[model samples]
Target chain A: MTKKLNVAVVGATGAVGSKMMEKLVERNFPIETIKFLASARSAGKTIEFNGTQYKIEEATPESFEGVDVALFSAGGSVSEVLAPEAAKRGAIVIDNTSHFRMDPEVPLVVPEVNRHVLKTIPKGIIANPNCSTIQMVAALQPIREKFGLTKIIVSTYQAVSGSGIAAIEELREQSAQWEAGKNVEANVLPVKSDVKHYPIARNVIPQIDKFTDNGFTYEEMKMINETKKIMEAPGMKVAATCVRVPVVSGHSESVYIEVEQETTVQEIFEVLKAAPGITLQDDITQQLYPMPIFAENEEATFVGRIRQDLDNKKGFHLWIVSDNLLKGAALNSIQIAEALLEDNIL
Target chain B: MTKKLNVAVVGATGAVGSKMMEKLVERNFPIETIKFLASARSAGKTIEFNGTQYKIEEATPESFEGVDVALFSAGGSVSEVLAPEAAKRGAIVIDNTSHFRMDPEVPLVVPEVNRHVLKTIPKGIIANPNCSTIQMVAALQPIREKFGLTKIIVSTYQAVSGSGIAAIEELREQSAQWEAGKNVEANVLPVKSDVKHYPIARNVIPQIDKFTDNGFTYEEMKMINETKKIMEAPGMKVAATCVRVPVVSGHSESVYIEVEQETTVQEIFEVLKAAPGITLQDDITQQLYPMPIFAENEEATFVGRIRQDLDNKKGFHLWIVSDNLLKGAALNSIQIAEALLEDNIL
Candidate 1:
């Protein structure tokens, strides 16, 4: 017989939170009881799962009393206050925010890349990687093992959904106004509340989050720091430029990597094809490559457009795509829980 | 007084050809007489230029008899057939097709980068660089001269208009279909005649042209070869991955380059600020940067997001944007003609 544990979902009404609810049901997780928790503003809301309606309650320290696993898709502030409380109550917390990701005591986990680290989470918190970082590391982990990665330079074409529900609504409204030849306003994209905003309808924005001291955006820094930490390679040279495109769902990355060992393009393709959570779609003759539109609801990280660099024999380029909400945020948090259960850690 | 010359615009009814007509009128080119020529299908059509309606006639060998300048924006096959004939006459042909760009006797020119090479056109055929290549090199030339470039890696976010009129129309129709919850069909994007077609309404297509044997698309190879030829650096390491976005007019590039000499980001900014035909828009505090929605119909190439690489002290990153029609094609061809007149090469 399988084990059925109690699960709690924080921020149940938001974008990533709702996705977590759907994914848990879709994956048929063994749940004896599930509790939906959110902010006071959304406390009275009702969400249906597995033919039963669950009423959302305001998440407090007391809410984690009987929970065995808590999936957190709330913002960093919520995670900062509630994640530790939930973990203290004997519930393993899978945090999908950046607050505890770099915490030394917390284990940042991507099941495909570094699930073994979940065996001993000193802080009782497993950090879900960033949406952009999750897809990239999932595709790169196989190559890193086979060829030994030394450097990575990635340029991302991320969708608007990664921002939040408000940004997605803003894009839809602005695009309609643009098509109708009316004036459009932007207040949510390229970092909402940043005091300045740019229109994203039929345009691409180079900024994703607040700029850091090093001139890299917070989102770009997250990719760089997360890759090194997850790969356990402090010496890896990783640089990123994250841009918000007009896409609504999937995130696409044009990644260039230089490995320490020499390898052929065929060998790289073979490695990716056999990867755990990757799907290789690189057939030039058939015009086959990954597109974000086709990757909207997929769990697999799609890899394509694999080619050798012109000057460096050990360098190669790849196009990687995946649903940011699935593999990037919600599904990743659930997978960390699955990993914990599979390894009998919980 | 400026010397007036007879000019003929071949393929006068196409997309780039129409933009050429608009730019000619906008820039007030010195023309004693301007003739419009097209294929027999568009012979009787009338196009208005500067309050004058001109009749389009079939272009034959005799059309260049009295023409001192012929701007060819037709397909490569058309240029292959009629360019030599026009050059055989006294007309200095500024061919905008890929047909003659690689010809050793022909000079591939971007006026801002290599106008000095226009001093002697031994073959009477000066080729205009590819639209994507023209904007990139125009922005990179100043840095190369000031810092001494050794390597370039570029990923392009090109607009649909770069494909032609049919692509623009397809984007519009597909966008409408997508919004209405209908099935979208693509007929002319990422390469018109390819068996597999993907919609570009809210998606990014990685393949810009037919794939080459070496895994790089023809469009990618164009950027590689054209950048080397126009910069007169045959041994420079150049790699490109061209993608088509849902944009309408402007082309944007995320470029990474390694220079031979040491320099600061501020020094590179000062160099580009004073460079001809380039505009620097790197004000992060004001959230000012080059965006395609704002770059439409602009005559200058805009550069922004300047930063030094984290690991490589000599490597830098840049975001370049320009109107694919204005600076990329029409304005570039007209500038080449003006260069010829200024240097008395014609």
Candidate 2:
């Protein structure tokens, strides 16, 4: 007999959290009960799901008393304090924050790339990989297995929505002001509290987050370290340069990878076409390729522009694009929940 | 004593040619007479320069009879048919087209990097490199000479203005339509005459020119081949992925280079700071870096985000930005003329 589960969503009012709620309803998961949890500011608000009004509750530890599953998209601190509480209350927590992503006990899971991690949740919490790291690894998984991947060099053209809802509002208002021949003001982008803000309308800002001591931005380091951890390829060489573009939702990457053995473009296309969660769009005759605007609202990652390197026979280049808000954050979390259900782990 | 010369600009009404006129007048070049030449469609149009209105003349083989120097930015087809004719009429032609860029008889020149090539023009024509390649090599020349560069991999975020004035108009109109809740009409991007066209508003297009046999677009090939010729490094491994962004003017690059010797970020910064036609904007503490919006009207190539590779000691990364119209096109042509004059070749 099939069992119905009670699910709760933390940070129910954020850019990613709202998408999580929509995806849960759209996918029509086997839910017997649904609870919307948020901070105190949004606790009294009401949202509609399944044609019923559900009042948002403040995410206190007591909120997870009877919840069977909890999906969290709150900030790192909120997850740090609440995720373990939810887990201790017998609810399996899928945390979408960087706080527990690198923790040795907490498993960082991307169901398409690594689904086995969901079966053994010793800490009762699973961490979702960063937005940029999620799509890249999903696109690389098939090739990594077939060709024995050795190294990756990626340059990302990320969207502003990755920063949160305020950043998206800033991009809209700033570009509109520029178009109207008025002065532009920017309060959230590149880094929110970094003491300097740059207008991102029709511009590409190279610094996505605060810089680390080694000169790589924190966002770039997230891609480097998170990719290694998720792929279980700690010895693999990975380098990233993350830049924020004026895009609204989708994130695109120009990925150059070297395999352990030489491979042809045809082999790569076939492998990725059959791979799960990836759509092949590399036909040159019809001028079909992946673009961010088209990737928005899409659940699958789009891969195109596959070509071998001019000088390096073992190297190949690809363009990967996906909805950063969907597969990158919201849909990925819900997919993890579905994986747990399919494996009968919960 | 300085010699005054008669200068003729073909395609005077075009985007780059108009900038050429502005640069020539702004710099107060030693000119006895200035002639504006365009196609028969715009022959009699009058333009003001140096507080004087000069009527544009129809460009023909006889147009260069009394001209000492000719600057060509009119398409590649126009240069293929008329550049040699202009040279035969006692004019030193600085051709800003890919038509003659790879010809053995023609020397591809970037004034800041390889100005010495202007000393001898066997075909009486000096070729200008592609816009994206121009800024990248200018930022790399000083480091390449100091460290002996051997490999380059670049991903470009180029502007729509590089396509022409018509492409710029398309971008503006399409973006306005998109903002007004109408479907975007794309007719001039990624390749105008190609079977399909992608919108360039709030999106990025991977293809810039027609695809070649090896699966690389013609623009990507231009960057790969022209970088070698201009740098005189025929053996250097160059790879490029050209993507057009929604920018109006400046072009930005995420460049990864491998040098022969091991180096540090500080040393590379010192060398670039002292190099001509390069501006260093790397200060991580204050979140300072080069952006396309800031580099739009600038002449110098802005470089920043310098860091050594984590695993490869000889590999380094940089972000390069510059105005595609100035340093990439008009200013480079005028600088080539200056080199020819200074070397007594004109």
Candidate 3:
């Protein structure tokens, strides 16, 4: 029998962190023991996992003392401070935050696309890609491999849940008020702590995260930079427009790709259909493409509406949907852990 | 003073048809007399316009007897048969339906972008571009005029009313049912007549119209082909993924363009803000943006979230939204009527 690993999930009370623990248990990660750690504010809270009640502990340098693997899904600041500490304590850290994503030392991994990158997981810590990038790379890798991508134009219809729990709560409350015909209040516009708020109940907000100096949001530029990094295609052209829709969980994207060689939509469809971790749902005659409600709770990245451009056959368009919190974050990190265990690295 | 022209708005009971009548009255199109025509089922209905009620007439060859300008918003089959009948009577027909849109002789025009094309209206038919394509060309015109455009990649979150009155009914009933936690059925998906149905309330549907043999939906290919025709850039590269969202009115697009000249986000923003018929609402710091809710009843196309790709400064991204029935179909047709009157062509 394979040896079980002692795993610890940091930021155990947050949305993605909570999902990470659930996934670890759902996938049966062979956890010999589990530690739940969060900030002091969430300390002393009891979380029930597999009928066992474990009180959340305040995360610190000593938090990873006996942990064999550490999963960090807290905010970037928390991961910035405590992830390295966990790594220093000899725990193989699978970080779901952006703190070490761009760090050359940390290997960013998406198992379906770049599972081989796990071989370079220097000493202890590894990085999980941004939620949007993970699903996109998963969908594009096979096509990129076969057709050899030259450029990508992506426009995302992201859910409000990507921002965190407060954004999700705000969406739910505002939608309820809008339904009642009441003038819903606004406290979460642009960003939560920003000066103003707008009604997002029935609207699409084009801005996601703060705009960087180059005009793309930190979210959008992340997709471009990370796709280049993960796919090892730095010269491959990629541009993204990330917009927040009223969706609760799954993130949908309309992706246009240009390949170096001629590729038909039928050929591209076959490639994606045969690829791993992808479900091809592109029957336009029956309107059976991907939707967030249908993608919720699923682990795989869903691709549909695959079509070739009328003007250019080498160009292809696809509609992609995946549960952002799952494939985009928690489930992927868990997949990485499973990979680690499979390779006897844990 | 320009001579007023007699105008008729056909298919007055439908969404775009209703908007046509409203726009004709709104724009004060130098109308000497107004006629409303529809199918026999809606022929006797009376619609109120500018404090006067006009009885709807059954659309037939004889309906265009003295009408100098005819706006057709009926379905493709209806327009296919009746449009020629009306056109044969010497009335200038501006069709909002897809029947004559791509016809070799018909001049498909977006007045703000390509009014010159109307002079070549053979088949006596002037075609209005698709709802998604109309707003895109309007925003792209200024950029295309100042800096030549080489490629356009657009993904639309189009409203359901673009389908017809039945779709509007479905969205209303489904949303009401969804809010009350009743069983919400999807009678339209992939396409309405298809065997299966999927819930669109609180969901994003990737397919808009029926898919063609090439796997691209008829709607997506329309945007691609129509962009070339309206922009007068036959060789311009264009691709689109048209998705139907639960939005009741406006259609939003995440558009990426590669311009011929060097352009920055600020330069593009300033150009769009200065352009007529375009409202720029992109202040990211305040979280202010062009959303479907704000663009609902607005005549002008609202564009926001303008940004530049960090890797390619020549590449720019934008979020565009506009009322589908108004600027996309009805307002454009009415504007053409006004232009016809202004030029004494009507």
Candidate 4:
């Protein structure tokens, strides 16, 4: 008989947090018991798991007393305050926030790419890569390993869902207004409360996160920095344009890359065809490619529209799409936890 | 008194063509007479301009006779065949297609930047710059004149309307399906009449036009090539990513540029503020930006979200949004005609 683990999920009512819980149950993890936690306002709420009712608790250090794993996804500020508290209670923390991703002490883990780094997981908290970077690295790691990557240029068409539940509501409300010929008031999407709201129903807002002093948005810069951290290739050149689209759930990226080794489109196609946790749907002759609707509830990253760069023979262009909430955040975090159990580290 | 010029709008039924007529009327173009032309399918239709209705005529060589200006937006192939016929009939053709933009004898015109080149509109044919490029150059010309540009990297969030009427219809119908909880049936967009259709309701399709042998979409290459011609800096380094979003009208671009001279965000802002046919709406604190909805009926190219690039002191990043049908195509063409009339060259 296998020993079942006790798991705690903080921010269980939020978008990614709820998805995390769903994926946990979907993956059939050996959970002897589970605890759902949220803010003070949501503490009294009850959610069902495994055909039983579970009350949502207010997350605190005391909440993780005997828990073997704790998942955090409230927000950066919330994680900043509670993550350390949760870790202090002897539970291993899988943080899904930017609070500790770049921290030297916290290991940023994407189970497929850097599971080995788990042995060096410093202390008790482990960082999950950003939603965008996780999906990108997941799709690229196999290619990177087989072909040896040199440069990456990616333009993202991100869904509003990546922002939050508020963004989804904003999109729905504004879209309804737009159809009614009423002025759609926008307060979300493009960026949380851009100084002036712009309609995202039928438009792509180029600015994702606020621009950092260096001109890249915190979101764009995260992809650049996180990709380096996740791929463990600090010297690799990565340029990204993160644009928020009307998408509700998935993120689609048009990625152009140059690799060191000689490779053809067909050869690269063959490699992605067999890549783990990746689906290759590139059949241009039949007008088939990875799409968000099909990728909606799937955990695997979808890669399609693979071709070699026209001018640079060493370069390649590939379209990568994934459910930002799933593979991007929730699913990836859950996978890391599974990896922990697999290695008997939890 | 100013001499009125005879004008003809080829492809008058189109998104861009309709705007050209409206722009012509709004600007009070000195037109002795206006001729609306389209393909045989739409030849007999009528469109209202300035509260007056005009009948659409079938385009032919005879249609350009006695016409001082001919604005062509039917498409590249249409212009390829009809533009020369119009030019041969002594009409100064301002083609909005890629058909003649790069021809040795055809001058690519963006009046704000390269109006001086109009003096040498040889072969009686002038090529209007690509819509995305037209607005970008409108904004950049002032900066380049003040600071001298060296390098440019742009990623475009292009509107579906750029593809034509069918795409707008597809977006509407597909969105209706998604909202109603039905499977979206896509028959257009992501390129019309392509073998397979994917839902653009909440997805971003990276391929804007058919891919050229060199990997870049034809749309991207046009932005690059046209920017060079209009700026008269054939050596200017420009890379572009042209993506089709769910947008119905406005094309937004994330532009990163480096200039040769020392400059700051304030300097760039000041220069653009004074530039012709350009409106600066960048107030990050107020969340004011150049969005498609507000830009719907406007003629000016709207530039906003301007900031200095962090990595390079000489580089600047901006969000450039404009109605692709207006500033990008029709309005720019009309402006060129207006410039011609103002110069007494008509």
lDDT by residue (tens digit), candidate 2, B1-346: 1888899898878889889988997877789888988889888989877789999899899989989999999898889988999999989898888899999889999988988877678988889889999999999999999999999999999999999998889888887897788999988998877888889988999999889878899999999999999999899999999999988899999999999998999999999999999999999988989999999878899999999989899999999999999999999999888878888787
Error of 4 at B122 (Å): 3.4
| Model 3 bad stretches (over 4 Å) | B311-313
* Each model's iRMS: 0.8, 0.8, 1.9, 3.1
Roughly what TM-score does model 1 have, to 2 decimal places? 0.99
Question: Which segments of model 4 are wrong by more than 4 Å?
Answer: A143-153, A190-196, A209-215, A233-240, A256-271, A281-284, A305-317, B145-150, B258-266, B306-316
Candidate 3 structure quality by residue, lDDT tens digits, A1-346: 2788889998877889878878977887798889999889998999988789999999889989999999998888988888888988999999988888888888889988888888877747899999999999999999989989988889888887787888887877776787678887767754775566776667777777777766678888899888988988789888898877777789999888889889787788889989989999987666568899899999989998787776677888888999999999999999999998887777
Q: Which residue pairs in candidate 2 have backbone atoms (N, alpha carbon, C) closer than 3 angstroms, thus clashing?
A: none
- DockQ-sorted candidate list, best first: 2, 1, 3, 4
DockQ of each: 0.79, 0.85, 0.63, 0.40
Give the CAPRI rating of model 1.
medium
Best by DockQ: 2
RMSD of 4: 2.9
- Model 1 alpha-carbon drift over 4 Å, by segment: none
Supply the global lDDT for candidate 3. Answer: 0.84
Error of 3 at A150 (Å): 3.0
Clashing pairs in 3: A287-B190
